[model samples]
Target: MFATAARNFVEEVDHGGWLIPVSSLNDTVNLLSVVVKRKRFWIWQRPKYLPTDFHLNDILTGDTPIQPVSIETDFIKYDGTYGENMKGSVNANVFDHSSFNVEGKDSSKLQSSFGSLKKEELDVQKLLRDSKNRLLDMSHGLVQQTMEKHRQVFGIVKERIVTTQPCSVIEEVQQGGNCGGRLSFCGGKSPKVSLKENGSLRKDSDVTMEIPIHTTIAYALIELEIKHDGRFELCLLSDTKGGFEVDGPASNQLLGASRAPMSPSESSHLKEELEQLGEHFQVLSALPATTRASLLQHITKVMENKEAVSSLQQVLEQMCQGKRPVLEEVTATESHKKSIQAVLDLLEQCGQTESAQANQSTAVLAALHLITSAIDEMTHECYAVFWMCCSFTGLQTLKKLVHCVSENGELPLSSSGLATPTEDVYEKTEHLFASCQVSLKRDGDTVKTEIHQQPGHRPLVLCIAIKGLASLDQSD
Candidate 1:
């Protein structure tokens, strides 16, 4: 029974753990009968219940040889638990003690070096920020100074042209010899005028004046002559020869001869007319000599009388209206048309050259204004000089002038491709001719007459033209 119980206990323990019974099996079986059962019976039952290779002989006894469990002791305890017990002290010293001390010193040196490197990086950042701030401040100051200088220069230029009150010759004559019978002067200096009284009539009274060219005001001269019959002539002369002589007339009979005696009002009117004419010539002096000569010749042909002036004005007015002018009367003669065409071609070439060189629309507009003002002045003087002479050449010249202005305005002057001032000029010119209706017709004798319906309207074309010219004049 004892052997059987021992074998069962060993088998149960090998499979899992030994299980104890709650009730005693001593009353169910006889102990002697159990003992009689063979050990071979348990061996056979064990193979069926557990593994086939399991056996009683494989079971370990208390005297069987065993290997001990391994415990690593090559590390130090960092919790200050070393030497608290004999086992901990013995294990703590297992590692090299001097190697840890050397590692600690190296770690301290690395920490110190890292702290210094961070401080240097911070200092470099601060220097970069300061340099950036200083550079911005310098740029701002430079820009402000440049703007201030430009403002001062602009103010000085604006103040250069003095707009004096219009002077009257009658007023000057009344004021005595000191007045010199001179009108308003444009630049810093006035022209030198010498008058000689030949008789009671202003006719045969030789009046000689020296006008400096506006462009080269220091050297060039326009020797002016006033005839006995109130006719005025211009000769472009230079001081390069030391004495003023005939450089040739600006235009053929620039002002027509007047036969009648001048009344007080008429004298004042004539003086005013001549003064305005002088200003226009002054502006023209800025252009090339050839251009000036050609324009002057064309002007002389056109300014014969009121009919011619009216005809010319009508054609120009039509041009300003953005419509083609009817040139039947002016172009009736091929010679007249060819002459006028030549003048137009010359003016167009001049405009093109100027436009090509000009980088700004403002510059082109200023040139246009100057040219128009000169034309206006010439037209006015012509109208005042001869109210009787009738000529179609004047009308042709007017057409050419309008064509020149339009051509110059159409140039691609600005980078933006839009000219604001040129548009304004066109608008004003259109408005000037809106109410005036003009017609040209030949009478039974083939004498052409310019029929004008409205006479009181004043044109603003000249005013706008002068605005840009005046600026250019100041700059020059």
Candidate 2:
């Protein structure tokens, strides 16, 4: 191809296709372009070694130097006719004869540099592996923290559920022998039993159960919330924690102050009566004054309104089917009488007035009696919250209170004749309550839970909020 191009260039010099002036025979002639046969193209007589795809021999891409070599070129021309042809050969330099062996000719210095590059690549891989291992350790710590929080929360929930369950099984077994009516909420139907001459049941018997429930403190608060557009404000606390390990070392250090022993003045009330009840008193005392005051105010408001309470008390008397037997009246000052009366009023407000009316009232009645008895006792004696809850109010005591209320109504006289205030005897009574050791704050759609873990106190805070799309849907 090179020979043909050079021959054509010589033939076209007359037409001024490529012209150059040479002063001597040694002067160089350069051809920038040439025509070979019917095609025209630019050509370079020099050898070139451009970078290749590096896939060759698995070597990296680099500047490769190629050396040109000499080759024999043949030229043909017609002298006068086609039968007489003349041919000549000459030595020419071309790209066809060139050497490309970069690896073999490289200096020792270049080879050493390549070795250093390979060492750097290995070092980079080691760094990545170590970083991955460190990340794995951190991930395990995070997973443990998340799991511990869930376990603590669930432990609290499980405990509350168990403590709140009623001892209805024993009551059911005892009532089995007697034909007396028993209420079971587990099913839709009530068990049929032969009654022994009980009083007539009113057409509004269901409403009898309804009134007691409606008049309760819980029910009253729910109503006030709906009517006044109030918020769901509730707080439950425990000074005694359940058995569960906390999260981490840093968390422990941060929470060290919370684990300090309670102050003498703070826990002084518990010293008087160190039982389960003291737990409540501790929590009650820890609560903010505003919260405690608001709670007391609501309670007092419920007790003062006796209309609903009176109606439910009558329901209990009817359910009992006649005045119960009276027992020896316990002596009391007018002030003491009034205090007990207020306590009774509070009980009635909590639907305890009808505890004797139904058997299914276990959950309600058990909690009601526990609180009522604790309140009355705490006024005169110091009992631990634990013992207060564990020991039930004597069955005889319930009958005695019921009988007195039934015979002459509230503030009934003793068998010897005692004068008691009937109405307008309410006085301000400041009781104690406490707070939990958890912090909660709202941030748009999320509630961040933070707990300062205290010794013997496992604090749990629950925040329920409808946010974002949920709020929009609820609006409708």
Question: All candidates' lDDT scores?
Answer: 0.26, 0.21
lDDT of 1 by residue, 1-476 (tens): 11122222222222222221111112121100100010111111111111112111122223332221222221211110000000000112112211111100000000000000000011223322332311111123322342232111000000001112221111001100111122222335756443322211121111122211111000011222322222222222321111111225633332211113221122233234334434443444456656555654553444322223334444444444355655666522333344445544554565577434443323332343334333333332222321111121222222322222222322222432323333444333333223222122323322121213322112223322332223232322
Candidate 2 ranges with C-alpha deviation above 4 Å:
1-339, 345-357, 360-365, 369-435, 444-446, 454-476
Residue pairs clashing, model 1: 1-35, 204-228, 302-394
Q: How far is candidate 1 from the true structure (C-alpha RMSD, Å)?
A: 58.4
Q: Which runs of model 1 end up more than 4 angstroms from their true locations?
A: 1-283, 329-335, 354-476
The TM-score values for the models, in the order shown, are 0.20, 0.16
